[model samples]
Target chain A: MSETVIKFGILGCAEIARKVGRAIGLAPNATIVAVGSRSAEKAAKYAADNGFPPATRAYGSYDAVLDDPEVDAVYVPLPTSLHAKWAVLAAQKKKHLLLEKPVAVNAAEFDKIVEACVANGVQFMDGTMWMHHPRTAKMKEFVSDERAFGKITAMHTCFTFAADPDFLENDIRVKPDLDGLGALGDAGWYCIRSILWANDYELPKTVTALRGPVLNKAGVILSCGASLYWEEGKVATFHCSFVSHLTMDITAVGTKGTLHVHDFVIPFQESEASFSVASESGFDELVTGWVPKPAEHLVNTSLPQEVLMVKEFSSLVGAIKAKGSQPEMKWPIISKKTQLVIDAVKLSIERGFEPVEVVG
Target chain B: MSETVIKFGILGCAEIARKVGRAIGLAPNATIVAVGSRSAEKAAKYAADNGFPPATRAYGSYDAVLDDPEVDAVYVPLPTSLHAKWAVLAAQKKKHLLLEKPVAVNAAEFDKIVEACVANGVQFMDGTMWMHHPRTAKMKEFVSDERAFGKITAMHTCFTFAADPDFLENDIRVKPDLDGLGALGDAGWYCIRSILWANDYELPKTVTALRGPVLNKAGVILSCGASLYWEEGKVATFHCSFVSHLTMDITAVGTKGTLHVHDFVIPFQESEASFSVASESGFDELVTGWVPKPAEHLVNTSLPQEVLMVKEFSSLVGAIKAKGSQPEMKWPIISKKTQLVIDAVKLSIERGFEPVEVVG
Candidate 1:
């Protein structure tokens, strides 16, 4: 009858971990039990600075947290290069895994991690925070209405942020040894996920990288884009970059309706998010203006999106721990699809922007 | 000295002619003097129904309007296939021409019209009404500021409308002999023009049509999209369809700022239009939301965009007529560039989505 609180272990203190750590503290069914880094002292300092519980332990390495019997879940915000290794080990150790976006460098590597999680019978989910936002649910509801929004015809998304000179030159994202996939993995992941989610998770028939992708001196992608085509005439295109002003946009057009969200990745306000929708819109007699103007719909959330994400992940972990339920396959399936598309885009770019068939 | 009103002759009784005739009436420097159609009765009915001035004349043939000495300028709102024939004739007859969009079936046909205008020293412009909106001037000013917007990184635009079953079956746009280019020339023209405008009128190096374009049984494009790449790494994309809800969007992202306009073709309100701008935007400490959120920029226009287009065209004619000045080359240059890109897209689609080098 007591509350089912899933104890989580914090990964290395990457910048994103600060936000996720705070989210863990805020999630009703989640608690941070330990912090891990290469140096035990650094882990202690990170836990103290990020307001982790006073009793939370500090570990000298990621393996220590995975070995701890008390840590039921591990939130892995480690560099993407380390994901395939650490994620598989975390699952083998019987710990629920909440991996970050771009779940792995590619889907081939992530398949091993998936196998480990299936073998251990532990819940697995990615850290795509926006998917848990209430606004996203509202948008999905509007798009699902058969009469209001008919079959989607096209969707376009872009997520870009201008990185400072120092970050552009020295950040892990731009360094070949660390998160080498760069902006495509960091920003384009959100764009691809949103596109697939809106398309009801239907993988594209072919992925073609757009021409003129920008890359750093070390061959790390700084800016890139790709177009996806489905068999039934649906098309989607996305652009991501570390060389543009912060802009996140998603425009979904259907036979009878259209949906637009300007701040899809991060809302302009934490408590409330809005999207514009126009159903069966047309022009006036003289075609001077729209007859029914698009209207904005606002959805308010009591908790921030990241906290909701943590809460959602923790609930699944709780079900496995307390009720002996099977691991949910939805999150892992979505994560794999996103990674597959990413891999296809990378291949298309590698093959001179040719179309690459997306493998199931 | 009293008033340099450019006496305008409308070349057809098409649905669009009604709007342009009304615009001619509203423009202070323009006046509808005559309307011409295959049937004189239909032309008269169109003129009366559209509120043309009482003294306006109706003619039994398009040639009659071009032959009238009082008609200093002619507004040709005929089908795209008929444009090359009538527009060049109007120019050869010494009438300044305001031709409808997709000025001709392709760039080759439009080039002949341009030649005719040049030979006769006649001012020429296309009927892309939104280009004359005051809001466009404001958008240009914002993107022109290098410090605020930096180098433009990417531009994406779409213009789509759902056609009724009747229109899908019988509309001139869906007919191969009338408007063979279909949605690409109708809706996609605006998208391509908008991209070129935002990119400071520089044409892309190559144009590649996206895969899976929808075509009608008669081989007219019903829905299509293309990606354009510049040599300097600037990329642009556009989609146009007659099978989707009415949606017009333009997202222009630069290194330092982003600009978004949902209703770029037609404003929601005739009197006011607005766009969102975010300059140097970033996230807060927790990355929960934007720090300096995108701001909406409202632009007011006392006159409708169509009326402004008519007035601007009239002013150019008046200058040429009153001072014996040579025709302003800007409008014709823009029209040619737009038509060239349209030709490239059609070629790319025909060549199995191959990248076609854009010809100047």
Candidate 2:
């Protein structure tokens, strides 16, 4: 029972943080002990509503909470541009870190975050939360089981949404000073992650990228595409567009069969995921026989996002508890790889959609 | 009935011509009176098997068919490299000409074909047969009809399929000098056509394109993408890939609703052509509640490739008979516009996917 309890602190009041706040309440072992925001009123309001005790402090500045000894770990839901600075500060204070996706705008910032965590002897994990979902695990299982779809040959993935032009202005997404990579750094990150996970995160032989018509007001790339290669001949293509209506779809076509996924990027309440498998003969009749096998089982994941985060974070905490010092967390390896691939894509786009090799 | 009947002359035994042959047989007002091919053996054998008269002469070259007194109008099915050569020659001979799609590889070639037909005072039609399909007409009506889907916001289209690597040795599609634009030229032309039809043939202001990974034998792009703008306000995007494992889909999203047309590229006999329109409120619901209106009419079209071609060619002949050659036999202005757009796309790919303007 004692080991089941883990204290959590919120460093920012973001829309995503609201979801995480709810998850922490639902998580069996997690407690929201403190809340902070750039605005004191916002911090106090969120703290009171999220079930923190009256004694639980509300801080106007992020530094006060990171300095608080009562908080075991901190969730950094700040803008992508601010992630590196705050994540490093949290690590230096010896607080475990769960930083958000696109860990930093670019590789250099990511390295700073990783270095601070390593030097401070603190645990760090990138909030690449989608992987914590069971459906992701199930997708991998289905692909690897050759009995289901044999000899994987190719995969195509896309994620996009029509974003409001108002939402695009002055946002960190459009600010090149923050090393803005735009769509490729944001939604396209998931596409690359899915591809890498499908292939066991093998380093691609070469990566090629292209960016679509980017309206100045709407940020760089209303759409973007990338092609990746693997050993002994395997190819993957991905596209992300902000100009289209919302969509999330991933598909893998093998020699003997094909696998399809629908509503992949966004999670629905009851039916978030759907997949269909078609054999060669079945493919011949795809126009008629194609059916979306309901992924009802993958929906309403019993464990909330906070619970998954806390549990993974707790493992690092447990290591700290046993050794009297925090061990290196999994964020650096995973985040580093993600940033490297994204950097290569950005380079490729700059070089006129040329193929860029992914080194280190 | 006598007035309804029209005579047709086919210039070759192309794989596509076979489809046209069947369509001619099925059309109410069409008859194949004469057939010609460079190989007398093959042409003579084909004439004997089909219902063409035994006297239908087999020639050693294309010019002989142009010289045939019995030949009225002609269907030209030749290599991608030879379409312009034979088409211009037939037009000069004053034969009503139905030339295959991509009328010529570039805008200049298409212009030459048009000039030749005008000088000879004959009917000229590019065999972009899909325009003849009722479904295409229906799609245009649905998108343009405000009562149907409302104002169109965006359109996405794809047409790609892997081909045999050795296809290039005998296939002019592999040779750039033969006007081969690779995947972007071949199947991509269809995707562009679909978008052009949907958008009412609006000329794009700018086009940004990216060449996909190249294939082994063809050394041409196996995959490609483009982002285009008809105006500052309206935009369209498309993807074409020969390396893909065969997929063809088109979707149009509008202010009030969305329309999805699957298998837009290749509507095989087994393929189902269906579209779903979603209400504004109902669109928010992820599953079943979208209130899908069923579309049950099946065109039951001919499966052979030549079927659509023959139907279109016969229709052109019937128009000439009815209108007495008052510009009724020519391809629509949209055909020329489609070639112009595609030509700009090729330039975009060559310039590393830079945005290219389509000159008015």
Which prediction has the highest DockQ against the true structure? 1
Task: Give one digit per residue, the lDDT tens place, for model 1 in B111-211.
Answer: 99999999999999999999999999999988888988898998899999999999999999999999999999999999999999998899999999999
State the weakest 10-residue window (summed lDDT) of model 1 chain B: B1-10
All-Cα superposition RMSD per candidate: 0.9, 5.6
Where does candidate 1 stray beyond 4 Å? none
User: Candidate 2's C-alpha lDDT?
Assistant: 0.66
Residues B1-360, candidate 2, lDDT per residue (tens digit)?
Answer: 444556778888876676566566666666777777878788888877665655567776678888887676888777556877888888888787877677777778778888887787677776666666656666676677775465665666766554545764545666766647777777778878888777777777887664344543545555666767665335566766655545555666554445555455445442234444442322232222123322333444433334555555656666666766554533636667878888888788778766798885
How displaced is residue B352 in candidate 1, in Å?
0.8
DockQ of each: 0.84, 0.13
The TM-score that candidate 2 achieves is: 0.78
Query: How does the DockQ of candidate 1 come out?
Result: 0.84
| lDDT for residue A176 in candidate 1, whole number 0-100 | 80
